[model samples]
Target: EAGVAQSPRYKIIEKRQSVAFWCNPISGHATLYWYQQILGQGPKLLIQFQNNGVVDDSQLPKDRFSAERLKGVDSTLKIQPAKLEDSAVYLCASSSTGQWNNSPLHFGNGTRLTVT
Candidate 1:
C-alpha cells in the first residue's frame, strides 16, 4: 500500500504571512490527524477527522490556523498571519476506522515550517 504523502518538506515564512500544507493519507484509512511538533517535544494533536467530518480540533489555534478534509480523503492545513512560534514540523497521520488506539498511525516526513 502506498504511504502517506506530504509536500514541501521545508518552508520558510516571515511573521504575519500565510502558509498552507497538504496531506494525502494512506488508502483505505478512515481516520486522519494533523499534529504540530516543536523541537524536542512530542507531537501535539492539532486536528482530527473521521472521514470528512471533524472528530477533534480542540488543540488547533483557530485564530490563526484552519483545515479541512472536503472529501474524506486528502486534506489541507493553513496558517494565516504566521507567528515566530508557529515554526514547527507539521505531521500528518492515518489509521483504520474504530482502531485508533489499536492501529498504529502511519506518518509522513512532514513539512517543516520556519517562521522568521
Candidate 2:
C-alpha cells in the first residue's frame, strides 16, 4: 500500500529554538498537505500544495512556519523560535486529484515535535 513518510519520528527541542521536519509522499500523488495535530484536537491543515505550487496556506503562521515541496515530491516544514504550544504531531498526506470522497486517505505516523 502507498503511504507518506516522515523523518525524525520524535524530537525534543527548547523553546525559541528552530527545527525542521521532512516528508515524502506517495509516488504519483499530486496533492500534498501538512497538518498540525495537537493533543485532543483533530489534525488541522497547515498548508496544501499542488505539484510544487501552493494551493492554500491561510492557516499557516507565516511568521514562524514555512514549508516547501521541491519538485512536487519531497517536502519540508520548518519552525523557527519554536514555542511550547508548537509541540504537536506534524503530519504529511497526499492523494491523487479527485480521489477524495471516492476513497479514504491513508496517513502514516508523523513526526512528533515537543517544545520544552
Q: What is the TM-score of each candidate against the true structure?
A: 0.96, 0.92
For candidate 1, give the lDDT of residue 38: 100
* RMSD to true structure for each model, in Å: 1.1, 1.7
TM-score of 2: 0.92
lDDT of 2 by residue, 1-116 (tens): 56788898999999999999998888888888899999999999999888899999999999999999989888999999899999999998887774243444546589999999
Which one is best on TM-score? 1
lDDT of 1 by residue, 6-105 (tens): 9979999999999999999999888999999999999999999999988899999999999999999999999998999999999999998643468888
Clashes of 1: 0
lDDT comparing candidate 2 with the true structure: 0.88
Candidate 2 lowest-lDDT run of ten: 98-107
lDDT of 2 at 84: 99
Candidate 2 colliding pairs:
none
